[model samples]
Target chain A: MAELVFLKLGGSLITDKRRQETARREVITRSAQEIAAALAATPGLRLLVGHGSGSFGHFAAHRYHVRQGNLEDWRGYAETAAAAQRLNRLVTDALLAAGVPAISVQPSASAEAHDGVLQTMAVTPIRTLLDRGVVPLIYGDVALDDVRGCTIISTEQIMALLVAALRPRRIIMAGEVEGVYTADPQRTPTAERIPAIGPHNYAQVEALLTTAFGVDVTGGMLDKVRTLYGLVTQHRGLSARIISGRPPGAIERALRDPSAPLGTLISGDGAAASPAVGGR
Target chain B: MAELVFLKLGGSLITDKRRQETARREVITRSAQEIAAALAATPGLRLLVGHGSGSFGHFAAHRYHVRQGNLEDWRGYAETAAAAQRLNRLVTDALLAAGVPAISVQPSASAEAHDGVLQTMAVTPIRTLLDRGVVPLIYGDVALDDVRGCTIISTEQIMALLVAALRPRRIIMAGEVEGVYTADPQRTPTAERIPAIGPHNYAQVEALLTTAFGVDVTGGMLDKVRTLYGLVTQHRGLSARIISGRPPGAIERALRDPSAPLGTLISGDGAAASPAVGGR
Candidate 1:
């Protein structure tokens, strides 16, 4: 009914991509509870959530060598995407069991692959589901590959694509850490957590981050942010955030404020400009 | 291991295609029991089983208008194929419960749609399963099609392709009827069951027969015979039958018999052979 908040649930926090443990159960359970609470806390705001495949997918994709190099194996990509679909179903089932009316619209079932890039994207079908108030969930996928074959379309790409197409007001990416840290907290003792990032310093922030360089095996964080930056700058579209998903109600606060406590924010103005401050 | 015998279990007899009801439970259950009994009775043979999507699939593909023509709407095909995949899982579960060690290898997961007409048949991944004495079960699939858009590679095509490539010893197609009949016995007062049909005359017989009718949705008796004929005519391959799959022990007899009863046997030599008369 109401406009939606495109919530991207990062794989790192939910599934522990590093250890290949589907550890997001407690977090997801709490998040779902928080989401329902958020719906109650706020008024008349619809939500469409997309979750990454966590370790079940990322670790498997890497172990199976889906993204071994720049060159890709189309079939392997498709298979890796299939693995993600399987995880999507698993997640959908979990959500449904918790009374979240979720559906999985796999990317492979939608996008027509043209070599390595998407040639045509059919979003009309998905829009109908979203319009009907059903939370349509999507994830990173092994997409139709024309050349080296199946390309891994990250959830970040999906988010960017959806934003570019829908021009939503804002996007929220839920991760394990509190926003984008100037450094990896686990490794560096004083890796300062950057409160906010703008289009102006996107390249700088990206330099600090060489891909999603944490637990993600599907690729690195760099691809995710790069994809988001590409979407925002190229399309001059909506704002997005990379928030820490581990917090009890981080997504809810992020949805309410331009500044959420968790993860970094990447606004359309390139990571530069007058950044939206976190209210926390 | 003994040469492989590829078995195709048609869906028409076991359930109502549209509603996906296990209407043929009496027959299939008995068929399963008998098949197990026969396997215990008979020795020195290995089998690779492929079950059709049955009513579960044909209804979706046709009802959804997927088969009307080829289009770029792979999404539609994806829906249809997903329907078939559901049925495949259900049937695989059923067979496993029936004591047949079958593993469902979804066609969409394994098949590649090239410039149409199945360029290369790859059972490469499932070879180890087959080698381990596990029945590698494949089914009709709405595979990711390359040309005619989303293509329906039917169970018939799967059999044809595998037989052509694997060059199996014999192929048995088990369905509802008591072999090929002169006409629809239910509709015709004097419909006679044809015990056997000569290779070249099978089509001619089908044109003149009355009992070749009925809920013969899968192109009736003639279509089955024609496919069976085409498949076995090579390797000077083993004989094939179109039998009443409902009768208890019929499939087993058909599978284990030096000669099996209950169906018309199509031989490469154009002889009107009986599975019971001369086991191929």
Candidate 2:
């Protein structure tokens, strides 16, 4: 069997986060192409693709307060789920159009959350797809929660769950930024990119990370980092890398070789971290 | 709490079955309006809408032979699923546009089958939606089967499972034809519609029923009657009606009054059957 890899296309990369229900078609197409190329190059490469709800789902989820499970009525639940599926269709379509055999696996239907935490997830269907050389595409969705009635789950959180079950070789988070930085690269011109993060230096970088704004009901960058950090801690050999998807070949490079200086690697060992990059 | 009703919008009624991927937009719009009107007329009415895959899914499923679980390759699984979701989006969009709070509850995502028989179904989310007064729209699609790798499940089959769980007051099967005819209406001009079918003459009518052809992978009319017959027999008080959706108020009438002289009613007791309708 080929090594398994989990790849997440950040919602911001595939959709115009500034515009509601707007998909960045060209960007998604290119990303799918790159991922397809990576698969062709890597023999026996098994992959699972997940994406954030981005603008499509966030606006509706936020309006309905689905994350807080404050659904005043059932419309909130219906609209929230519908909005997420809308984005899921776009992502899956783009992937399929790009010659990737991507099938959508709706989390709301098969998975349940408890107090915003995933309690049960059916990964058997996903495993079947993977075993047959097909890629299962999942996204951030409004899920039924045992404790809160319903909650918005992030792609990163879903990926974390899948990693535990599938035991993927590694996880690649393709976002807008190249890697983790000491400060917001847009706001802090002098902010330097971090090479890696681990137990030893995670604390210093954790404080520097900023949360995202806009329609995202799920927590932003900081939350993603925290989730990955938690996963890496539990699984000894598991590692994750956050890299920019904008630049050509960035995702492919990260997937083909995670050790390359393309992104910030989060792992159990601190050996990959460069202290000189950023430490406050 | 209002009585729950299961409504199925036949794929043939909503889509041009002869053409692949073609949705009969006007038909869907009309059906949605009728359903909305029915809800308006019936106070405390809770409904679950299910639709057939029609053109969008049938062609791919037929090509892949998904119904027989004859998946020579995995691409069939992905393509078949993707095709079904495409149609589901169209159906949900129509319902939402008609001002109906319809949410797509994917069967493949939540339900599993064992050799074409439903093994487990996660319906808590659907129940939550219904409790909150939102209509959960589901459809026919490919599902994971314990015995077979995967199998195609029909809208009626999903409804059958829901009927067992939710114990809906009645099931409304909206289709292209008026109801179960004594013989193939198109082929047998002398064939007349059967008003009702029950244990008394079910065996005779079952022998007269013919399966549908064209793009549908699921066994058509005969399969629908068989499934409904089983459900009606198991649930003493629960009943089902197969009615034509092409007429203006067929669905509304069926939902408003199952005994309305508009379609064939299948109940526990054979009170409405007219033997003179079809036997040659």
Candidate 3:
């Protein structure tokens, strides 16, 4: 087995989050193709994939505040989980069609939480899947919470759980936008992509993200960055790249060679001298 | 909601267990229709349904002895789970098409065992689903075990877990044969159907089950009786019926009226004097 890599296909990139239960089939298929190509290029590159529920689950989660937990409404918890699993079936079927040998490891089934914080998850199935060279695909879903009754767990938080168990070398996030920007790129015309963010510059970047106007619209992205930043900072030699999956072959390029340099690279102690090439 | 009912669709009833991944789609569809009709007829019945993996999971499980647990063979664990989930998809899809609001509650995802003894399971989802008038469909699958690494949990055991959490009035098990017989009905021409078995006659019934020739061929059926016997003995007023599902309207008839008396009734102590009409 080679160095392990964790790849996240962001919900916004794979589905139309603004709509209800709408999946961007082309995007999912293309991403699957890119992943298949990457594996073909590097046969020994161990990978674990997670996807977000996007419109499928987020609507119900937000409407019912499942993330905050709802003891009174068990329907909300079940609906959230069912919707997310519906999308997971789509994504995993596409991966299998592309010969990725993808199997779903539903987060809601194995994950338990206390006050919205993930506590225990069955990681043996996942670790064993990776060990046997099978791509275990996980997704965001509802989890049982001791305090809240039931809560929603995001793909990043699930990844964080996996990270604690299986220390991967690189984390690749494929989303709609290119990478983390100095400002909200959609609103600000002068927003520049931050090429490299390390321990030394993380505080500075955090400040920019906090003060940036219209960042609230992309609040999910901000949360993702914060989660990834915390992960990279905690584990040395662990790096994360937030890259765009829109352009053709970008994901394939990034995955085939870890140093392909097409996204915002966040690292810990090492790789401070990485070049500031704009993620286009 | 009215009185709750736990229904188990035996693997041998729904799928060709001897074959690999073969599903009797007609049986499943008809069963779904019967359930839908029954629920429609009795509007207030709260139901929780469970199905066996049949050919889907049993093949791999038996091949690798997954029920016995194997620490070195993780592939077997995954394969077993995947196979079972595939069958669940088919069953759930059929139920949905038949106008049944069936949502799969995968047992392996939430179930844990210590040396094959089911310890902690997240029963909130199933309980809540029943409370909210939604049918939660659970199936037998691979579960992580503390001492053995991984093992398979059957639908009967899963029901036993549910029986402890939510005490339903009755349990209906659908299988290929009608019910418990005085001998191996398949091999013995003189085998007579046992109308009912309770604490009063349990010793005699066990003697018949054990001394019967060719009973080992139906070993799974024997296990089912033993598990159900344990459950009924522990929880009074809760009776179980083992009936054949081949007849078009047996399930619908049984579900519509709790006292329909179509199968062998295994009761604790309350129903010992019930009529001894043989289960046809």
Candidate 4:
């Protein structure tokens, strides 16, 4: 089997969450270049890219109350789905321009959630493309639900499901912040970064991490940690690293070597000791 | 089971094929209105709309040589797929504006082809949406092929596959011309229009029909007839009608009455007599 990696580009990294439908073009282009460099360094590496909806999807979904399901009018569903696709297009285009063969795969078309939990996902098409050395790009979107009629599915949720099916070597979560911190680093001067986490220390770290501030329909850092925690605990061999994409070489480093002292690492064994008071 | 119809809006009808990437917005809006009116006239009607790639897809697919497959460069695949999605967005937007509740279900994300033959398609999501009374809008797109690497799959091919799964009440092919004529209507004034075609008279009528003119990556009229002929013949109960979308009430009439004397009908049994052409 080829070495596969699942990477999530947090919406905050690629788009301006403060403004509706505002894409951070320069940041996205730089990130794509970094990803391309990583692929060049690692031979036979297959990647599955998923990005958060950011402002593009969240604003429209919120305006229409799309996540509530069973709306008096179904037009909101169409609008929400379109907005997500628009963002996916922008992300895929940047990757393509940066020499990555990124193909857009909308989740709503092939995924279903029953009461906010993904029940069935057709991943064969994605698998075939990945085997052929093509990058399959996915994103958060509105999906049909058996119990709720229709609901919003987050990128992290979709990635967790994909990790189970594809069994990627490692998952790299890239965002604006360096990693999970003891508290909101921006607000608290005494806060410190947590370098490593596992089932043993997950609850302790979870209590310290703060939810991201902005217009995010999907729960921010807390939801991401919760989803990754479940996957890492269940799949002993799998681990996920959370890193800041803003730095020059953070993404490549996290992808190339997960245990590097650059960012926080979450695993099943909890073998690595926490590095203290790292300078940002 | 509610009544379902598989309606295909030919790219030539909704777009200016002579000009690359130019969508005929006016025509699309008019067609949507006709479809909406029909849905209002008949209660409990469900629809699955599939449109051709038109200028948007054909131009990129041709430029990239995507259909030939096994190309040295893979970037063409991403380009081609992006082009198709652009057109699908425009179409879905028009349907939503007309209050049709159209949702885009991208074929490339959940569909695979083996040597240009569709191997697997995750149609369950679409089925669920249709069950909830939402129109699942699909389009011709670039698909990964096991044998050829990647190939372009036409809207008719996708719709034919859906017919087997959904077993819609009828299939309507809306295009620029009124119907399949005995000869090139523009060149041959004496040519007559064939009202009905079946297994018995298909070969004779097929030889007389002319292929559509333009830059269509997928073969035009001849290809449509061959696909529908195979489908209608084997299914026995299934029938497809070719009609002009330009005329007022033509699409609504065709959807409501497949055997109506408006266009060419391909059926298992030859019931309607072939109508001779008097004038256009």
Candidate 5:
């Protein structure tokens, strides 16, 4: 039986900001179906899914200049939030279409986190959905902050909040790039693809992080890894992985077999890690 | 017959921010009653009202560093908007309670013009409210802007928008003080309340205009007169008056009779004038 797994779908993996997008509804749907199939085979696995705002959030933020809170740009914040909402609805609807009895927990309604980390996540009603064999689909949203005002609540941040609250044992971050890389594949020609990494790989992890992912207004990949590592290690017993979201079936394949080297795994010091080959 | 009016309610007239308040709800309630009564007496006079965010908007915007666009403060904009929303609902309820049949046209739903004026005002519904003797109420909101980002669309701006769009014959701006004065009442020994002046009364208005008045994040008499005069005289058929919002039942008197010496009136010639006194 596999443990409870948190699946994080990165916006970059699912969207192209260069083009206006209708959330990859079909893809998310198919993925949910596949997950449901896989879960039937593994009775003990608890699955929680979260997707990003994709092309919707980033482009709208840039279009409206929401980053610069001028007196005139206040409504830009509202419009930007509305865009995130449209994308969120698409994703939630897709899950339900796949027969994943999903519920939309609008982050804005319960977004009063102590410093944005979910001091009180009203996710109990969400647990009922999972019990009814329903998938509670979570996504990146326009979250209300007590500090920095309105901002993109990144999928990674969503996962951290869920992990701290849900106590998921295994985490998988899926994206198109086949897993976390040592550097940008397009920019860094020789940037190595990290097959697997853990707590002991601190130097290796820090070296792989780049400040070049286009100044994320809501933080970026580096932010995700840094945040994940902190949360998982603190839990003492939680095991997590960073996996490629691509090949369409990669997530299911990695989850089904422990040996599949899909991404970096962050977890406990005492946990047995893959003795697999360090990829080039 | 008095012309339909667009009124901007200043912050000081509503909330006391220094003490961190939801404001005395009765002041807002009574003011709604007064506006309703005035409108009822003069069937020709209709009002589109906008109120300031007061205690909620100021402290939150600054305390959360919302303008800085920090990651943590993402929801601050919404939080503050909700705060103003509470006041708006209260005001609307008050008017309804008084049998005025008022409706709140939240800024998010209304079309605006650069926070300076309004164009394409879909005031049919508001007009409907007026047809039925209902007042259309608005508030200083976290307005959605196409440019100049996240500014508090001052109630003055909303009133300016309302006046320009509706081409109201006269604007009655109500504030906490007795009326627009010749000098700041708090600072000057002879800051005699200017009973009247020419339309372009900035010189006198400036004298009376203090830097700020408590929870009034918007500037003093200068800004008030400047925006009102700018909007009213944009064409040939409009005029405006600046008067005290306090001392219950005063605005009603001014609305009921043009001869009422309620506030300083600005006419089309860009010279200061009193509502009925004419320039001395």
Candidate 6:
């Protein structure tokens, strides 16, 4: 494989989370185009694309309390999977229109969990797709649980597993906002976008992170940041970027140049500049 | 819940099996309409729909010999799944247009196998969908295997599991031919359709049955008949039908009246009136 990359299009960036099952087609189309462009520019790029369910799935999961694993609420689990696939279909369709060979790999079909923790997730299909130079599209969806009956699996969780199985060079997360901020940027006018977080400034950055806003069943922004932090720590020569998907050419730029310095970079080696480190 | 039924649209009936990746859209649309009409007529009907991969997936599986579990052929598994989903999308689209709330429950994601034998398949989603009065569409696809790494699960295999779990009343299989014949109906002019197969004539019928024709990774017609026979025998009072889908109202009739007698019937008890038993 050439240089493997895992790109995640955050739920909030592609779909309106406040509403139910509403997709922001334009944003998705643009993201697809950017991905296609990125691949064209870097033909050697082996990419695995994943997206969050957003408004398309969270409501069903929330309404049914699926995460709680109510044995009587299998309908909730079924609907949640259905809702997620509806959104996935739209995303895949957009990618196809943009000339990307995107194939949906439903997490529920191949993922098995034990009491809300994913124990077995088949990675053969994903690995095979990348080997054939076809972009494998995966997303947050339902998975069968041994103890609870069934539960939801998030995109980040799926990505984390992929990272371990296939040591991608870097992970790029495109979200509505630019990057990690000192506070919830939407609410805090004085919140500053953290340039980079490393071992030197880990405590400082952890203290400033806030819970994600809106209807997210999966633990929000804080959990996401922590997941990324843990991944980079565990894997050497690995780094991650949380960048804004709003500005035109932002995703393409990040894909073309891994060290574009456009967003908050999380690293384990502390090689990435940590401005707050000197003060600490 | 109201009376439950499992309807399988055979691959040969809804796709050009001889060709690659070809789907019989008109047949699918018509089948969907017939299904919708049947549901409309009998408001108490609970239906679970399943379709075969046909040309959409079998070729890839055959080409890759996915059934044999070549660890080096993960791309084959991935492509087989993609091909199956592509056909599934078309089938679901037709159902949606015909006013059916059809949601695809991928067997690959939730089914686990031990040496090509399906050991565990989550039925909660299918059961829940029926409980909500929504049609859950399932299809044969790639599933993770404990022994083979990964293998294909056929529609009949899935239906068998569902029958054991939910205990549906009857299974209606729509195929290109009228029903089980003494010989390959397409090739043998003297082939005779067995009106009913029961314990009284199982051995005789089994001896005369022929294999299915076309690109099917899963064992063809003979295996399908044996599965149905086994299912009926295992679950007393449950009966099954293998009828031709080319006839406009065949599926509808089978759905509306379980004993309409338009095709070959397989039953555990001999009450189905086996014509071939008198001589024996």
Docking class of 4: medium
Whole-model lDDT per candidate: 0.61, 0.80, 0.81, 0.80, 0.60, 0.81
Cα distance off (Å), candidate 6, residue A172 = 3.7
Error of 4 at A231 (Å): 1.7
- Span of 10 residues, lowest total lDDT, candidate 5 chain B: B112-121
Q: List pairs with backbone clashes in candidate 2.
A: none
Looking at model 6 chain B, report the run of 10 residues with the lowest lDDT sum: B210-219
Screening candidate 4 with a backbone cut-off below 3 angstroms (N, C-alpha, C), the clashing residue pairs are none
In model 4, which regions exceed 4 Å deviation? Answer: A210-219, A256-260, A271-280, B63-65, B210-219, B256-260, B270-280
Which model is ahead, 5 or 6, in terms of DockQ?
6
DockQ of each: 0.06, 0.58, 0.26, 0.68, 0.02, 0.22
**Candidate 3 residues B30-89, lDDT tens each?**
999999898888888988999998899888888888888876665677678778877887
- Per-residue C-alpha lDDT of model 1 across residues B1-280, encoded as one tens digit per residue: 4767777788876667557534455655665566556556656566777777677667657755555434533345545655565555455556655666554555554455554455444554345445545566777776544454445677777777767656777677887676665666766778776666666566677566534454444265556677677666665746676777776667787777646546766667644453344532
- lDDT of each residue in B210-264, candidate 4, tens digit only: 3333324324677778888888877756777888898978888776654567777
Ranking by DockQ: 4, 2, 3, 6, 1, 5
Stronger candidate by lDDT (3 vs 4): 3
What's the true lDDT of residue A253 in model 5?
71
Score residue B130 of candidate 2 by CA lDDT.
83
Retained true contacts (fraction), each candidate: 0.00, 0.54, 0.13, 0.74, 0.00, 0.19
Tens-digit lDDT string for candidate 1 (A232-268): 6665546667777786777668766654445666666
**Candidate 6 lDDT tens digits, B211-239:** 34332532466787799999999998788
lDDT by residue (tens digit), candidate 4, A18-56: 899899988888888888888888876889999988888
The sequence of per-residue lDDT tens digits that candidate 3 reaches over residues A7-34 is 9999999999889999999999999999
Model 3 clash pairs are none
Highest-DockQ candidate = 4
What does candidate 1 score on TM?
A: 0.56
What DockQ does candidate 4 score?
A: 0.68
